[model samples]
Target: MNERPRGIESVLVVGTGLIGTSVALALREHGVTVKLTDQSPGAVRVACELGAGDEWEPGGDRVDLAVIAVPPQFVADWLLDLQKTEAARFYTDVASVKALPIEQARRLGCDLSAYVAGHPLAGRERSGPGAARADVFLGRPWAYCPGRETSPRAVAAVLSLIELCGGNAVKVDPVAHDEAVALISHAPHVAASAVAARLVGASDTALGLAGPGVRDVTRVAGGDPDLWTVILSGNARPVAEVLEAVATDLAAAAAALRAVSVDDDGAIARVTELLRRGNAGRSRIPGKHGGPARAYAVVQVLVGDRPGELARLFQVAQDAGVNIEDVRLEHAPGLPLGAAELSVQPESAEVLAEALRSHGWHVP
Candidate 1:
């Protein structure tokens, strides 16, 4: 097996929750030794049992990098204590926001020179080690904030770690990082929650009639409330600013909708234009960071739930030189067949569909 670079032999990951465990797993995949720890001893044990890192060891050993993946509120204090030990030569954090931690670190007299702040713009609704995936960060954009006191070596080490996890790193100032995340991540969470909150008391009949659009809009609302509360609190100012803008736009939309009357064709057109602008604005968001926006020619196909059906479909696609960008499986009761939503490049969709159909699979 390949080994980590000789100079950086050991990595200590503080907080073995979903993000931390996933970082350990990804680092280990590249043959790096990792030590995992969390406030709760049981949580640390769970991470080790899940093979996220090596068994915990007491005392400070010479280590190259320490990745702090705890909640934003706890990062500064943890980094303060970790910096006192020889356990780490340099430190980096995966907190969602940056400015607050930098300020807190300064207050704690932590050595910002050996610390770099990083945020990976990738996550899932699930929490803890069980939900961690080695490839969770693959192809995702990781933002790095190098404070004024940050050292060259510290920046380089964190950049290397980002690349090692199969991510692209972009440098941004701490304030900029907070503002950007407020617009893209934090505001969206609040919006999703707001939408989902509206449905809390809806009748079963109303919910049963909901479609994919509603499902997609409210998906992030199912995320861990405890985790989100910490994140939202840490970046409350920027988040509130963004939400205020959203409120203004929502008010205008409501006004336009309320203006619908027999003599209000102009108001109706205004509402339509507002909706169009929303669509256009959303389309501007990058689909996947590394690659171009995937132009998916979605193909629905019928396959059995039994083993090998998926393998056969994948094999057929591979043989046809069709790279499947994404896949979704749906099943209905009383039917032996399930529908697979295959997202392939538009150019290969027709040929791939034909190939699967020729293999005795039902293609739509």
Candidate 2:
């Protein structure tokens, strides 16, 4: 058989955590030779064991491209040293924030011509390669920031890499990237964490009453605090700037609640409007990778844990000429009843609920 084209053949992935290992797996799936390394020896070993990449030794033969997925604080310094050693002909990073590292690179007198800054806007609350998914970046937006010293070839290489991993590339200035993510991504993490922290000292009985709304709101709070501390600390100024606006809104809420005997209609209206704004804002968050948000119909159903209960319910939906887009099994183990939140087209939701109810399922 003829040999494959050799341009940008070998790629090195530094840091074999969730992001790094995921990148390696995605590249390897494209038949690209991937070399994986990490500061944690066990992590590297685990990544290799999980088929992320071939084991890589430090100061080895230079690869065509190097993707550094280290934490934000270390990216700039690491890139500087790698550039000095000519570790790779082209370099990019997967750090959430970009401007600080880019500035640090320039200060270190590294050849910026060989580097590009990139961020993949995809992650789970979980950390490490064990949580890495090959399709993690599929259809997701990957931001690219080209420095003045970055070469056209390097930019192209990174773009191709993003595409190979099934991500769409969006170019923006490094500073803009940081600020945008501060609003959309970083800010949400802090908000989720804060909300979750408030539940820490709550009574067990109070916590037992938690529902899906609370779970969804606090989901990202389960993320590694150590990692989040680095991310928030690295982008402190931008994140703090966004938080100040949130604080102002919160203060307004507090003042409204404290107003005694005053006609609180205006304050109540403001709160309601704020909640409405939240619904509008949340609807704009791209669904699954630039797709329309997954619209769900809340189907309140009484379900038993008996065998074939789920299968029978689904069969009824299928028979009703309704397609179930997605299903959330919300049930407490050892309980006889549960609710299935069915995510379906708005048009089909009512039909499915009716059909299920007709089939003797208590679907509200």
Q: What's the lDDT for all of these models?
A: 0.82, 0.80
- CA lDDT, candidate 1, residue 261: 51
Q: After superposition, how far is residue 317 of candidate 2 from its true place, in Å?
A: 26
TM-score of each: 0.79, 0.77
Tens digits of lDDT, candidate 2, 114-220: 89989998876679998776656754679999977789999988987886675768999988999999999888888888889999899999999999999988988
> What local lDDT does model 1 show for residue 67?
92
- Worst lDDT 10-window in candidate 1: 286-295
User: What is the Cα-based TM-score of model 2?
Assistant: 0.77
Tell me the spans in candidate 2 whose CA falls farther than 4 Å from its real position: 1-7, 260-265, 288-364
